[model samples]
Target: MHGFAARDDVVRSGAPEDDDTVLRILVVEDDEGDAVLVREHLQDGGLPHETVWVRTVDDALSHLAASDCVLLDLGLPDAMGLGALQRVLAAGAPPVVVLTGLSDTDAGVEAVAAGAQDYLVKGDVGPDLLARAVRYAVQRRRLEDTGRALYQSLVRAAETTRLERALLPTPAVRDPRLEVRVGYRAGRDGLLGGDFYDVVERPDGTVLVMVGDVCGHGPDEAALGATLRTAWRTLVLAGIGADEILELLERVLAAERARPEIFTTVSMLAVHPDRRTADLYLAGHPVPLRLGPPSALLPAGQRGRALGIPVGGGWPAERLELGDRWRLLFYTDGLLEATVGDGTQRLGKAGLLEVADRTLRGDVETDGAVRPDEDPVVGMLLSGVRARHGGDLVDDAAVVLVGWGG
Candidate 1:
């Protein structure tokens, strides 16, 4: 108003009005003349906007609940300089543009560096300039918000990956004669579940193997699975008797589980030093498949109740005779429970046996020997399951293979 004689003409030439894109601005200015001038200029800009003027930083913050961008005068009745900016930022930090006197332009620059979207010198701004600055400030603030959100997501992803790596068990057996292979796939949620497995060779020359699944799909369940696997490894390494191991594990699960409803299904095998026999223990788990000249589920009468159930007697350990050149497969229920094709029917134990038979037949060499470098059995089984489910598994699957003599 001070520089222009007829303000009405300037308002008409600023921009075309659009009701749908009207901006709401909150102006914090103590001086009545300056406040009127700002309101007139914004109206003259012809960029449909609703302006609410406040004389103090406190009043500006109160109006912010309904306002989009804040046009703040650094010099106010209650707050001055960067102090006013700091208060506004502390209260939610919406998009902001600072108003400064021509002589205090350096302060305006500092305000921009300190999180203000943009700044303007009071005497130098026209209706068009004011509207443009407000539009650009909102855009810049949105970009910054989006970038910050993306960075946080990347950080969470990295942390989840690290946790998953820590939970996976590495084979501790050094025996070249005992070949061990494993396969694991997370569920559709893109997060690791409670499925876990471990293989360890004791000093007594016995190879201990285990595959277990806690009853859930989440970070908490995954962490619990890791704890159980670690505890089992520690007990086996410390020469804990195979007969007492499951009972001890039951105690650990009871103590460590987050809720009473949570339970774990586990299958364990302890192959003797002679590699001639092994002990099989099932805790409400699928029986281990014995791959021979014929592949089939081993005869396990009445699989034991899952761990965490109140049972007096421990899980019955059955003796398994493992002659020369034998392979045993242990896995979580996810493998057998996966849906096959587009049907509601699941790929049960029978389907798994079929897959295993196919994988073995395909992996054998013409010379009547199995390939040693790669584990085609578990790999093919997982690939087949994924293909049947259209490349998205509903649950996490884990498989471990223990073999002696070719």
Candidate 2:
């Protein structure tokens, strides 16, 4: 019944001086004599380590979790050969250095392929060899862990990009007289944010435009925003009335929301192909800016509460006389919430109109002959906001511009 020498009595030969960083080793060997020899070899080696000895695979599993490395014996009392090694590895054991007999060295090699980090024959291993094997195994395991983490990060980034593309889709309008332009900027939050917008020209010669913001910023909210936008597009395409569309959207938001507290602020506009009238609906959203003969914010009387709010209500659609020429701008609250200068004062709705007017004053010629590739007024407005903020906006921003008979 050989046993480990007392820590005070064990002579430290060439072993490195103990420091704060000590490598912990779990020795899973059935024979007490073999375990004593292995501990003596590591103590005499120049590496600082603390060893925990266990006689069976069951006992070893308990100590495996906190150990930095494992010195596992293939021939345990209850387990034998690679079966023992496979069980320890499957239990999420740390880096393993399999201990093998002279005849079973081939089995040790197989264990290495089966996920053990390294292997050493009992009779051939010296103090230095044992320490070196343990050190190398720990380092290799850390490198593999790091590589796995980086690969997972790349996969997440690719998925985020795909979701963002779906959230902000291209306008589905073919009318030459009607111009639709959109600009989007994701906030510092992440690749995907809660902002979304969509434009669609119906079969009956009517254009449906919407801009919305879910309550929070993250993957869940971004995904919810995309779902709502798709639902809106489907409803409009199916010839749902403007009033009925918002009611259905409210039900969808309530059902799909991750939490009851989450809500969405949205602005919707329906423009007739005759270019004589437009209907506006505001649900706890900002008033749209109309660049008429005189630039002003369009009045939608008595704005309704945002969707998903506990309070029940209906949003009334206000119809406006579009006259002959009009350019309308719809945006999320992030545009008006941008901070100005070094203070907390927001740019607000008035500031946004001024920015649009200033940009339009210089680009009158380009505005006369609009091309799909040319910069739209919404892009210019976003640029002004970014310049004022000194960089990206604090929250996700989305804007859609619709022009008819311009």
Candidate 3:
């Protein structure tokens, strides 16, 4: 192969670009004479490169990942013509430049269409041309990869916007007297989860609030939550009572769920305009927390099975007198179930209540008081839960707090 043969007095492109980046290149050529020429061209081109020569396609496949680019010879014993190019590409080879014979220009053109970055005539390739081909091939392939990733990210962003709108909707109350606040945070990975909520104040000045979780996480669970939320808003707009609305919601969940094991926990309320009472419907969910005035978490009633459970029915309303001035909070389990200390125990309901007390009434026993600038808000409660978790919560948390008066 004359690998150490006399240096060919190579011709330069007159433009000596200084590039110190060493490229790792794979040469798949059975002919030793041609392999020597490829090596000489790149070595003489003044391009920093690590060249590896292989005699067959099988050897090339092993080093595909390690190589930044590949120079493939079309006329190989085992791999003939376009078949060699097809095989390399099928094995997920890197950017490739095919070496064809003088008269095989037609095959070279066909190779580019078959995914080769570029093709060169075996005898006519020069030091400059060969080096440029390798560099451009790698650069072009990298651009294509970046473009594909960006397109996929744009698609995901659009889908997320649609799902978020459905999951969190505008309040329907016209009454200025009632104040409502809500916040939602996804689980650990920042990927959206199944927790969702919706609030609508009815025409009679009665306020409706619901917070629920569709079992599991990801786009599918998120989609189901959005679907259920839309249905809840529709039922509320139609003036369905709290219990019947829940029953209908259960049927919708069972029908729409992708798997039989999938179920949903929900807490719904119908608060009267008088700002003094509400009808609560609980389904395997945490009891509502009342932070101010005449109430707190009292045993409401027999909590029914969550929607999609096999043997559950009769969703009934448990009435409550919320008093004239009250602050009521409803949330998904993500807030209370987060891990607290050494991970052996979870910051269950009691832990959350401790934080909630500090967030509102500035109880200094635990994490000190909420600063004067920070008003008592549900978002603060969510932040407090995340702090108690020691980081991001392991589950999606959704919260809605409603207040009637001072």
Candidate 4:
């Protein structure tokens, strides 16, 4: 028949005349004499505290959140022994110190093992000892909470790192004459962003490269980018034509996208085995930069609509006569959209080219063997972009530089 009490039901005492550091203590005991003794102990300790005397476990549960520490009795009318302690804990009661009778000393030990911050015998406890135990219990509980939070943060960090590695993969170029450099960084150094790129060399000696961006940021967009990138690689390896590859990729995007409004932009280009000419195809994507003796933005002629557009369109190729000593810089929009230092002007195509030029280029040695991690040009370019923006870019950024030394 016992139940929650009215707000004014609990007998309150032990609060100081004036102070904010007063600890609120909830004393859960059915015996009227023991409750009075506990309140007297709290007052005698000379500590600024507020004590709420409750008669049952039910009443204690109602006051759990308002109390800084719980002084619980092992025996209660509605609950017995550890039953009282377990219910208090399950109700999310704050730091708890179980009170026990002399015959129940073993029960007190068991209660501490179960989760009580500390335990005290009823008759033997003094005012100073009770005060010290309550303070210790509160401090210990806070440390445990902090430890739990730190552990959860570490788990999230590990997951983010794994996603970052998945989003930035190495190119699969087989030609010694072909040099590929790449870079990727998540926006705000937060969760992985929706930017992905890849390269593959065909059996016929031609190289196919691609860079793509999903419409939004965060984990969903990042996962979508991975899906599109993987599908593109599969289509290319299966010998699909560039045009058909994009069309099929659109279907993939449309099917896997998290929402109907979501879309993707892509740049797919094919470099002939001879390394003298290439065919570029853009679908609502940024134009690649032609880094020759004079670096310039390659023309994205009659661009096709971005993949997953409602009406749907095809991605046509733009033939490029990239003579000897040429490099192509392909990127997601994040690189060019950075706001200039304290201004509204964005670091657009021109700014990107300027950054590329100023950045120290670490090309492959004569041996044409540089590890993907060893490619430093892309990293420098990214650093330049961040410097220009005065901070990290607000969107996920990715860049790929394909070169041929004719």
Candidate 5:
């Protein structure tokens, strides 16, 4: 190749009319005659090619970095064959095409695998072959970059999954009288949607449990839900009542929200271990169902709107007895958002209760008989909704069942 000369022959911009014109190529061949021949062929084949020859690997690395394409000769004084190609690829050079002699076919194959776009045999290739190879190599590298970006996105999603699990709160309870079971599923699959739950055992021996759903589904909403759950637990530990806790949550939701439209629905359950009495508070959240001998849907009494709405509004609270061995189920709205038909009608609270009752009594007719010993009440309720929709719930669904087994 010709000695290093600071010339402006290569690396020119595209024409004004052809804004997306052909790319400029830099030929890094140590042999001066071979480099001249390659440039002649590229020019004859109607390629926008430029030759910048460097006898040593150091000069080649610097020159290739600015070039759109490279034609590298495997045999060089400083680096030979695969070693030189390795240095070029390691230096983060653009797409390169190896110039190999007829005797070094194996070396050429290795160079291509090591990261060269393509390889051509010396003393045999024509102008069209040279031009086509360069164009195709550049296109292939572009596609490879795209694939790498998509893989990175999947990696980020996997990392988010780990973060979501870590954020799930473990119930804090010392009283052996209460057995709390909590579960959550995001409605928009593959993302951490805004749904959260927590259980905290305060210093006063009272168990505080909560489940909430933020208005929108996105990272911002999920993050807000996480923040609210942590704050609620902290306030409960600080000795706040169910009613006051919900009110404070509303204030926090109002202050910390990213947008004015963002709101949250929450249900708080506080149980006294000694008395077996519980207080329920709801702010636009689904009323938890009681599963026991009475097995009925308890009212949450959400007199006020959801959090972040009409900021600082308060809601009414209700007191109920667990009796003995009663189970409470808390869930988000994704479970009830299913449409009964093509119309605007939805399987709302009443319809959900009817399904639960029928499932418990084994009166809801289906193709198969009720499985023996299976929790048919909850199972049937979920199944009924899925059946209506013809498959899994279209929206994300989450459930937390707290059983006060005496």
Candidate 6:
């Protein structure tokens, strides 16, 4: 190697002594004479630059790993012709500019097809062309990197939306004796949170429904929520009762949860269609309010702790008869956590019931059908909470209203 020292390393560009931004180039060439010739041309071109020469394919790869632009001589002693070009391109960001001997412009063209940004005929090119080529390759690589980053961002955003939609529950029981509705609002605009719900109708006509909130916001929380909802649905379909399903779900919560601090508050309801009786299982969650002949919060008995963070023993499922045309409002804490005033006091369960009473009793139209007391029940809950909070709630909110149309 003529004056050309072989070093496996990256070349970092420094501002020229004259204060101009200089382009950095990694030259992959085995011949010292050729490397010097290329550098002379680039320096002579009045363009500021520093070239780091690597002689072998392995050395070039190491340099590629560290650097961004490559001025690659197609024919090298260790890796010859287009093979050298391909290896460099595959390594990373540096767009390649092929260096070719006079008779080998064809090879240079072929190298470009294999992903080289441009080619230079060695003996025929001057300093201006050499400098311009390296600068152009750098600009090209920058654009390509920007585009790749943007595309990945778009893909990630779409996945988050899909994951969110998958985790959300759709009402399953359309009993003439029940009116079922659901509401969900993500606290952060364009962000996914850990709220989830699912309603499944078993072969025996028992409706198994659940609503839960994993303890955070973002993709990880959303993903775990989706996993938990899916597991719950599968367990219900497998004919598991509420207690057994909760135990199994706790196992999943332990295994699939991304963080140890993460936990879930869930409520599962099993409605027996024939007898019109519903079994309620609480797992450290907000209780469901039974809006019966007189709309009110059905008592949420003291029971199980949050899943994964077990307090002690298991929960005994409670059974209740579904009154004719009853509406069950199941919600996440975000609904009640909304502030009732500028003070530290929260809406709490009792405060929420008060709002529900006022709104449900007032003429509110929901689903376009306004019974004397049948206002937009779900809307009132969300809007009323926000009005009291001074704005939207600080956390993600979700709601499910199961109305049995007697």
Count backbone overlaps in model 2.
0
Residue 46, model 2, lDDT = 64
By summed lDDT, the worst window of 10 consecutive residues in model 5 runs over 7-16
Q: Best by TM-score, which number?
A: 3
Candidate 3 regions exceeding 4 Å error are 1-24, 46-66, 76-84, 106-110, 293-295, 362-376
**Which scores better on TM-score, 5 or 6?**
6
Query: How do the residues 1-406 of candidate 5 rate in per-residue lDDT, one tens digit apiece?
Result: 3233443234232223332655767777777678767876777777664556566677777787667788888898888989988898888888989999999889889988888989999887788999899888888888898999999999988867765654466678777767666555444365777788888888777777788888877778778877888888889888877668877887788888998888888887887765378888888888888864335688655456677777565777688866766778787787778667763777776666665567567666442422353344545656665555555455655566677656
Name the runs in model 4 displaced over 4 angstroms: 1-24, 30-33, 39-67, 77-80, 106-110, 360-374
lDDT of 6 by residue, 1-406 (tens): 2254346544333336543466667877777778777777777887676667777777777666555578888787778888887777677647889999999999999988888899999888898888888888878878988999999999987887788767885665645555666777677354768889988787777887789999877778889999999899889888887669989998999999877878998988888866367889898898888763355766566477888784687766887777655778888998788776665999898877776776677633222222343226677767777777776568888788776665
Q: What lDDT score is found at residue 212 in candidate 4?
A: 92
Put down candidate 3 lDDT per residue, 233-297, tens digits, no spaces: 99999998766898899889989999999999999888887879888888888898887432368
Badly placed stretches (over 4 Å) of model 6 are: 1-68, 74-91, 104-110, 126-143, 150-158, 187-189, 202-205, 216-220, 251-262, 274-277, 290-297, 336-380, 383-395
Where is model 2 more than 4 Å wrong at Cα? 1-68, 75-91, 106-110, 126-136, 292-295, 361-380
3 against 5, candidate with superior lDDT = 3
Off by over 4 Å in 1: 1-68, 74-88, 100-114, 127-143, 292-294, 363-376
- Residue pairs in steric clash, candidate 5? 1-30, 1-31, 1-32, 187-396
What is the alpha-carbon lDDT of model 2 when measured against the actual structure?
0.83
lDDT tens string, model 2, 180-278?
889887776646788899999898888889999999888899999999999999999999988788889989999999999999999998887787898
What local distance difference test score does each model get? 0.82, 0.83, 0.82, 0.84, 0.73, 0.76
Top model number, lDDT: 4
